[model samples]
Target: MADKSNKFDEKLPFEAAIDKAGYGLYSYIMTALAGVAIISFVCIVFASTIIVPTSACELGTTGSQQGLLAAGPVVGSLLGGILWGYQADNRGRRKMLLVSLCGGTIFNLVASISVNWIMLMIFQFIAALFASGLYSMSMSLLSESVPMAKRNLVVLLVSSIFLLSQGIMAALAIPIIPLPFSFHLPALGIYWNSWRTLLVVYSSPSIITIIWLYFMQESPKFMLVKGHEEEALKILRVIHRINHFRSKEEFEVLGLQQEAGQEAALTSSVKEQVAPLFKMPLLKYTIIMTALFVINQVGAFLVWLPTIADQFVRIMQTGENSDLNMCQIINTESPVDDSVTPCSLNETSLLIVLGVGAMQSIFNFIISIVVNQVGRRNIVMMVTALCGVSGILVNLIPSALGSAVVFGVLTLGVVVVGLYTAITVSLFPTQLRALAIALAMTGGRIGSFASIQILNLMLVNSCDAGFYLFSSLFAASAIVASFLPDDRRGKVAALAKEETHKNELAIKTGND
Candidate 1:
């Protein structure tokens, strides 16, 4: 058998040729796909802040009922992720993406006009089912398309851009859609309720993204594996044309001829592809990664702003010892009312959260540059440890200094989030990539659900215990990080191939 590390062993000639066209076109396409994925994050992160509160007010929902409404999308995402992963791996990433985006746009548009909580929940779930596909497919497609040397950086960049989109949505949710059209839409029969209007605006990106994706080609590697040599060649030709500004006719002729020869020489059995993923070596690595991801999700859920806001408020009050009240903070008024008294944080907390989000985006961008150089394991370890430290400080700080401490802790949390995003994208093989991401993200969703429940039960009663619980989860994540293999800078395909060979040998010896 050929050494799996050799690029020739894994990629067909035509597949390699696509990468030769230049990184610019490839990077652009990845960024576009990544942007689509960000819509899901934006919706999920801002739901409690911008969507749920508005929904609760407009629908006259009880607090417990509001919690269920908030959980609708995540519940939908958990199921959608698993379904989309199977579809993405078996069908094609491009097809999955088109279907997901188009469906999401329609669902979100409908959600904007929902008459009651039931209708709203149903539409939100439908939207999530489509939106969930964006992240898993994007990671799988980008990981398979790029060169091994540049793969980590590309993945990091994609994740960073996705995070940045969340910040953009946060900024826009308050000032643009909710504020400007809040009253104007009532005359137009639109009833520009905060959450409804936000959904309407959020769906706008999906419309443009779906249209753009329609013109994009499928992954060349996916085409080759599925025996669509001509289709793969046409895609390669287009890429070459885009990168070099060559005549499409000339590139098509060259590409088809090259792909035809390569296809004849390369043959991979289905068993070879499927067997290694479930056997030893690969199985071991999968278990370790899955466990690390599950632990990471726990911390991720705990650190989310909405999940801990009530607890942080209590800490702020204790520190300030002022008559800062939540009752006066109405939807029409600013978050902070200076006329009453100075509290721990009012409108400044919003700014602090935005600043933290911006800092997260910047850190993620830097991680994109340094990920391939420093390697994945070291970065994960360092970031996980820092997150643990921050989580502890968020709870330990005195009430008077709580706001400052919370801001600093949030900054560190953002940095950790960037690192986790980079590492998750780099940890799986192309064939199993979507499944791996879905599984990890599903873990996060589960954590988010549990954290929400904890908040409803515990934080509503004793807020301090909630912070301690969150901090403990962060510490556990650091412990899990220490168990992961140091394969950050390595090629996932090469690693998968090597593990396959070892598992094959072990099976043969056992039979003998």
Candidate 2:
């Protein structure tokens, strides 16, 4: 018996590498880096909904223009998700993440100084094109780097960046955008306003990303999948050194298993690669995850709370808010009056909304903490069900605070979306992992875009009907969550191997 464990090692080299490296300091470094990238991306994401339209008002654009501007990043993300996703699958995860973040920051800065609506949209579109890939790629990179035991919680840790980013943007915007600052240049055909300065401030995360790449390393598992066994081993040992606080420990595992005939071609066309995800077991998983993305629009509605809560205020308390809704208020066809800017908020209201966002962040963190104990599927279904019921409670209840409380509960549904991302990423192997996440998020990006356009139309008439519609969607998501396969227990790699073996057999039989 030369080596008995060699056969077991051959079958699951990736798992073996993970076993050797384990989870400690290396995992913490990767998790923190991924969280920062997510925070940077999310900083732009939150800005698009809140700050972009406010910028539109600052520039005196129309409702149609506002809708188009808002959709710019979502569309960029739609394309970037797929394009960068396929690239990450082939080129390497870490490289694509660095490229996307760097490029996104550059264009974000350019968009801040755009002369007109067209320039703003174009620059922002290009920014989105480069930046959106970080979303799915960072998730895969983080997942592959961490141990199986801590995967779900790690994903949540990265996702909590959204809440942190939102608060940071809000805190910055409250002070920056409200300034009586103005710089007009007729020669440049640009009238720079406080909103522009504030956007540049929000885009500061670009610098953060550049610094992150300095300390990070490429994922060893990705190297293994790409047929670099020696390089893979080298990286794993380095991770082991950092994690175990030692320099000279041998990793017993040789390498991750490579598919038969995989050396014949390093990569395939995007379609051939992505097709497997749409077939059999993987197909069902993709659909269920996409449904989660579609139903998570409750977070978007909550963004309108300031406008909604403003309706309950008496004229004596806060001047004429105009009987107009959020869409009408922000999307004025004429020049935005100097007297009332979007950021013209009383200190009381500003503090209250920030408090609400902080509260939602706390609940999301709680979900992450309990995810390991409660199970991923159980957590999503339970939270989304309550989110659905909260829709009804919002209507039955009275007072601005009552509706506000219900909407805050509904925001918890967004956290469930993060758990869904963690669950979805766990299902695919490295070859299809990033692409699967991108595909599922494509549905989400589409939903976000369509919802904004639809809400701009719906929020005008029956705001009550809007809440009911969102409620029904969340309820439907809970039903879909019921059908998703729970793969937390050593199933993803095994399933991928089985699927591959079945394909090879089918090919052999056809040739025979």
lDDT of 2: 0.70
Query: How many pairs of residues in model 1 come into backbone collision?
Result: 2
Model 2 CA deviation exceeding 4 Å by range: 1-12, 246-250, 259-265, 302-353, 487-512
lDDT of 1 by residue, 1-512 (tens): 34433423234464356556445565567666665666554554335444665455567777677667767777777778867876786689989988888887788788888777788888888788777777778777766666555666766666666656645555555454334234545543545545566778787777777777777778876676567767776776566666656434234223322322223213433344444445665566556565665555333332334323433344454444333222111111233434532222233334445555666667777766776656576777766667656655654553434534553553454444445544555544444557656766776667666666665555456655655666556656666777655554455457545543464453333233
Question: What RMSD value applies to candidate 1?
Answer: 6.8
The 10-residue segment of model 1 with minimum total lDDT is 324-333
C-alpha TM-score for every candidate: 0.78, 0.86
Which of the numbered candidates is closest to the native, going by highest TM-score?
Answer: 2
